[model samples]
Target: MKTSIIIADDHPLILKGLNDFLLEKKYNVLASAVNGKEAFELIETHNPEIAILDIQMPFLTGLDIAKKCKELNWKTKIILITFEKDENIYNEAKNLGVYGYVLKEFALAEIEHCIDSVIKAMPYFSPELLSYLEVEETPKKLELLTPTELDILKLIAQNKTAKEIGELMFISNRTVEKHKSHIIKKLDLAPIQNSLLIWVKENQKHLE
Candidate 1:
């Protein structure tokens, strides 16, 4: 059977372009959505094998829909198309069990590969996005953080509060704060006021 898919994007031209492209490729284009709400509704109704969602949309973001899908235990695999190359966003998508991450600029070239990988139950991230993240400084700094510290840093980058991180890691809030302090000192960001969060935001691309 042909792979059934639903495509969602806020832009009319892009949505039409993607729908046309997928139809030409002979995939079963079950539906197209103009926003995340519509996208989720179509997914719930059609139960398509794959969902291609733009990261930014009205009412609900693509990540929001992906999280909802996970919560509902939907089988529809999510492929997030976005202009964002932020590592923190990518990390969140991965954590939410997104099957594919395709940059909008590379969508035409990479979407087929992404779909194929997802069909095989594998994860796919755009090569262009990966290439942009291949910075030396980030890795060098990341090497200073221990595995536990790195985990906490990722949570911090996600904007998780100390209590949230503690609950997620099965630790106390005080321990989470201690880890944050160590992370700040190790990254040499303690000199600046409120630098840990700032540093995480600035260096997220490298940290990932």
Candidate 2:
């Protein structure tokens, strides 16, 4: 069966272009939504195999929709399309379990590969985004964070509680708290009140 998809973008031309291109590729385009609100409704109603959402949208951001899907345990996979090269945004998407991240300028050439990868339950990050990160200088404290610690921090930044983070990561709440403590110490923010959360907010731009 052809892979079914719902696409959401605020820009009409880009939305139509993507719709036309997917149809040309022989994929099933279930619906097109002009804004995030409509997109969420269409997704819940249709339950398409995949959702391609623009990062910025009216009423709801793509990340917002992704978070909602994660919360509801929706089966639909999400692919976020954005013009941002920010690491924080990318990390947040990763934490939210977004299957694909495609840059707008590279969409025409890379979108097919992205969709195919997501269908196979593999992640597909834009090559351009990866290349940008490769060249960017890593911050000292960020470098000290273990992969697991960084993942937990991203969840915390999204306001997920320890229990929620533990459930998502399949670890215990105590383990999550332990990791949080390590993160705070590693970042050298122990002196500040609510230091981890404060540091996450303050350094979010660099994290991105």
Best by lDDT: 2
RMSD values for the candidates in order, in angstroms, are 10.0, 9.0
Off by over 4 Å in 2: 135-208
For residues 55-127, write the lDDT of model 1, one tens digit per residue. 9999889999999998898999999999999988976776677888899998999999889977866567777
Model 2, 44-112: lDDT tens digits are: 999999999999999999999999998899999999999999889987876677888899999989999
What's each prediction's TM-score?
0.65, 0.66
- Tell me the lDDT of model 2 at 39: 98
Estimate the lDDT of model 2. Answer: 0.85
Clashing pairs in 1: none
N/CA/C clash count, model 2: 2
Question: What local lDDT does model 1 show for residue 200?
Answer: 64
Q: Model 1: residues >4 Å from true position, as ranges?
A: 135-208
